[model samples]
Target: MSEKSGHSEKKTSLFGNEYIQHYDKDGNKCGTSEEKTTLFGQTYTQHYSENGDKCGISEEKTSFLETKHYTQFYDKDGNKTGTSEPKESFLRGKYIQHFNEEHEKIGYSENKKSILGTKFRQHHGAHPRDESKKKIVQTSASNNDSGDGTSASNTSSSGKNFILWHVFAGLFLILTYFFWQQWLNKQAKEAEEKWKNEVKIIASKVPGKWLGHASNTVVTLYLTHLYGDRFSAKVNFRGSDQELQMDFGKGNYSTSLFLTSRLHAPLYFPITIPAYNKNGVVLIFRGKFANNGKRDVFCGQLIFDQNWKILGSFQDSDGSVGYWSVGECDGMPSNISGNWEGKWERGGLWNPLEVNQTRFKLSLKQEGKVFVGKVSYIGSRGSSSLRGEICGDYINFKYRYGDGVVREYVGQAAGDHISGTWSQNNSFGTWTVSRK
Candidate 1:
């Protein structure tokens, strides 16, 4: 009996000891097997062609003492063409050599096995096959005397078969990975779409905005399809605030939130704000739809950041809620408050400096929603008062040079550096600043 996996086939039979043979598409007998035991009770699988021609043989002996591997290869003429025997020690060192039809040493290789696969160096005259490929074929070859000594014409056949099999296997793995990734993306997209639809369905029943205030926080919930979700909400903690994102799937409901307490002003430019490290706040809300009720309502406990637990209720049709407010939670500060030193460049906006031509220094100070800083030309010492605000993870600042000459800077802040565009009136240029 035989089974097929991709382009390779494995055939099994009694053969006195239940050996198996492996082959490729071109009818090349790639490998054969047989079990044998010596006087010392050492048992291993032997490799040969059906006519008893030793194609290759490998035996792995592992016991309490040590583990050793013995491998040898022979051509169609029953002559020892190659031998890869371990040295005295059970180390990675191997004495590997190859011979031609005349039994003359034609090739020799140094093989070593490490964490990153096996490393081999074959020093040969003309024909050089990869030692790894030889090992792969030898490792799988079994003993089946029904087959011939692999027809010397097919000596190189095993290498070709190995290459083609790997090519097919590599392609198969790549395609499988690509399809798996696409499947994951599709599931994520479907989840996002479902959340949006649920928001809409619930929002339509409400038809208006609902506001709930508790303690020092104010909760404003909007039910509309305009802002993407059927239900959108904003939570203001004392002076810090940010929006919330909801995920409802598998009967479990939760919301991801961000703490914008350090931000003095709310950012509305990107509309959908990108999450920062400081903005990872999870709020798990659990509830179920009452099937027998007159109206749609959600009653659940609001678990805030795995800390504060509060009970809340919301009526979908009237846009009404009870005890729906999130209190203050400690969050990491922003990563953009420090002194930045780098170079600034000008485009068509100015002629004094070439594109990215001048070095500059900026001393930035963040106070709530404001960014106060000073910019000075490094070589020229010419300075200007810089004032801007943290717009999400970016800086929107402006400075005046001479005679009402204004240069506006918009840069994205990343760690110690700020890179963005500068526009003077209508002319545009680029600038970069690294933290001092």
Candidate 2:
């Protein structure tokens, strides 16, 4: 029979082959016999049979059983360059192997391990210490038990933490921006409100007045109407200084001036004639007027109101000789209501012979006097109007003639009489009226 089938074959070898072969549970020969061997000065022995089979074939020891331990060579930069099986002359303890460009072992570790240790410490010092490195090592061991690499966990955890940090930071930034914008809008609104209130407070301190004027040779007048109606005024030149007063029919007169009222019936005058009435007898006079020896006889009509006051007088000749009764009068009358007269002089020369009149008219409706009228003459030129008042004294009224000339009068009223200065253009003059 062949030696493989012999039961008592000689198994002696010069390598001292005391070993045991391992087998699977099915009794199949799974490994070779174990034997002890020595290489270099280290005493590690193989745990396998002479046929290259494992002796202790447990799962935990499979890697050691299948691989042979060999010395690896590295460059000074710690890059692996060569590998070799351990030999009899190999040094024990920690050592570094040196290799050439061809990956051949050219040198071995010497006392230079001190230098490499120093370099390793310096490298660690230069970089930030990873406090999680120990945990990473433990995790690596756990991964090795499950046959997976440890690098995947480190990569995944790092990426997850990085994304989480960015998301939180982005949300914080967005909220901050919105809050800042709202604060700015609030500030702007408050500022605008404050400015508007300040302007209003400043504007409240101004005075209220319509308009006024002043002049040397003129009396400026501003007239306002209470009742809205249009009236007319005419200035007639009756006669020069010391002229006879005679009856003149209609269509005969000298010079006549006419003025009109505004849309609201208020007359604004800038001038006035200066005079005042002394006697109170209201005279109704008709005369022929002359200017530079040119004469024109003018016929006129006179009337008074129920208060024994002259209302107004109208002249048909040259449209001159109208008079407004000054005092309190309500309506028209049939005759002159008061005997009123006045005289004026300029540059020490008597201006002309002129008749001025005033009268009071009783009001049938209200408790106070109503109308006031006045008239003045230079040659045949004169103006007249009837005025209304509330306080009876302190009269304010306006008059305008057909020639668009407006006059405003404001003055005081007394018993059965009124006196004030009328203004037109840049001239002013005193005037008075009385009851007949």
Candidate 3:
């Protein structure tokens, strides 16, 4: 017999009042009949193995005239073998017996009328050699011809705690994952705020005039902060006024720039200006910073590409049509305060070869008679500090080389033109330059 949900009937047998006889799946020898549950007169039953694993299942119910016992058997693999109807005997509604399909005696239950007029059930099955079957499911002390049997107490465990352990483990893992995701979100938010603060610090250093020196033209840039990562740019190429940058242009030659590009160290902005080359050229500036902090400089070059070579990086000057360098500059000087570039030639200079022609570029900042700025020569691929002064049409300037050597230039200025002869100690050269 197995535990059931519906009502289980009381069967009176020759022994005393008890449930129906319990047997194994094949009805051969009885396993310990577990106290599967005898509810408030319940009827359905579930069977489990010794290790708390489900093995087989069967149930039984009693009627007025007959007793019906339906038993289902299972194999080791838990597959259903078959169901059997037990051969039951109720002689004169008093004596009863239960038999298997092989007609061997298995167990039995009988009904007895008590003095209180209630029917009492008693069931019995025992073997002398097998003490397990001798364990009784339910019994009473109104002894008959049957030998005394001890009450069957459940000796098996159901492994409910093992299943509960698995349930708790799953819950714990879910909670850990939820908290981990929350932590990641918090870290991302903090990083975003830190980046914004850094940009704000950088923004304060911006919003000023930056000057670009090129072999072909000199460019002046005015930056004004508008909002987060945004600004307005007005690019004046010294000469080209109507021509505007592609991405920075609003109609009628105005601009509102978005700072989403390969950023500069001191000045970060997009530079996609229109360069007129008769075939309508556009110059996409990719400048590399020489320093990683404020007041830095950037240098790059423009290559004349008939079919646009997609602008990518400013790592080197491998392909150069005209080289350029940009830097933070003091506001435009008053007079004779612009860029001048030309070539210089001298006889018997260091490595003499007829007349060694060297290119020179000067960015001048003239104040009264004193002017101070930067100068670069073609042989010296970098710029140096320049300081000079102009008295009327006659001007004189000197630049310091990297090795602390000074080169002075004395020239006569006429409008935007300057013709001079430069001397560096015991070396001298003739030079010609003009304002860009």
Sorted by lDDT (best first), the order is 3, 1, 2
lDDT per residue for candidate 1 within 47-115, as digits (tens), equals: 654355555443332235656332434333333444332232355233333334344454433323335
Q: Stretches of candidate 2 above 4 Å error?
A: 1-369, 372-385
TM-score of candidate 2 on Cα atoms, chains taken together: 0.18
Cα-based TM-score, every candidate: 0.28, 0.18, 0.29
lDDT of each: 0.43, 0.30, 0.43
Candidate 1 vs candidate 3, TM-score winner = 3
Off by over 4 Å in 1: 1-338, 343-359, 365-373, 387-396, 402-404, 410-421, 429-432
Query: Candidate 2, residue 428: CA error in Å?
Result: 1.6
Number of the top TM-score candidate: 3
The root-mean-square deviation over C-alpha atoms between each candidate and the true structure, in angstroms, is 20.5, 36.0, 23.7
